[model samples]
Target: MPLAEFDSSVGHSFGLEFDSVLIRQITEVSGLKMEQDVIELKQNTADGKYAIKKLPGRPKAGEVTVTRGLTEDNSFEQWIKDSRFGKMVSARRNGSIIVYDYEGMPIKRYKLINAWPKSLEISTLKAGDTSVLTEKLSITYESVEVD
Candidate 1:
């Protein structure tokens, strides 16, 4: 493939899909990390030396963060509020963050399953600043599927 072709696919344009809705105002999505535990074992060698062996243990998914311009809709806030009021199980949701090409086609997608809001922060307000208010949402999910 040519440089131009690869460049387009790596473009910054992307979308966040959740609750059957596409959030186009998202400015950034990050913190998709996966890690596994390593179990080490020591064994006796023929030369009277000890050798270490490593084995995979458990898998862990890190938190995912989504930042976007603050909107009038209070859906995210409501979900957090509900979760705090003994509705956490019901408030959990599944979603996906998709990276798109210059032509607006999806090139990659990170699917979030059984996700729920772990934290939400509204941008700080300044007297003379003209920047728009943005909300940062951190989510915790059971698993992540990449496609």
Candidate 2:
């Protein structure tokens, strides 16, 4: 593609979807990352030199934090509640973070597998404050796949 024809998607132009249903009013999304532990092995070479070899270990579980403007929707709260007290199996969900182009078409997607809400936080409220009320939800997942 020509440089002039290329349009990188902006960070603000993104959305979240759970089980293919688009979540509305998502103001921010962070921590869409994958990581793994490193294993190091120290050995003596035939030349009697000590060397440390690094190897990739088990993959770490991924976590993502999503923030949205507070609203009457109680679905997320319900999901968080369901994850408590050994109800995690039924609360697990698959979702995606979608990035959109300038025309509002999905250009990239990061799929979260076997995800569940880990925590929920509401922004502090104060009298006479003009900030938008928001809730932040932390989700933990087995893995993330870019599609």
Q: Pick the TM-score winner.
A: 2
Instruction: Report the C-alpha lDDT of model 1 over 26-78, residue by residue, as the tens digit.
Output: 88888887777899988989998989999998887668888889999777788
TM-scores for every candidate against the unseen true structure = 0.87, 0.91
Model 1 ranges with Cα > 4 A deviation: 1-8
How accurate locally is residue 97 in candidate 1, as Cα lDDT from 0 to 100? 87
Q: Which candidate is the best by lDDT?
A: 2
lDDT of each: 0.82, 0.88
Candidate 1, pairs of clashing residues: none
10 residues in a row with least lDDT, candidate 1: 1-10
Any runs in candidate 2 off by more than 4 Å, and if so which? 1-7
Tens digit of per-residue lDDT, candidate 2, span 16-82:
8996679847899988898999999999999999999999999889899999999999988998999
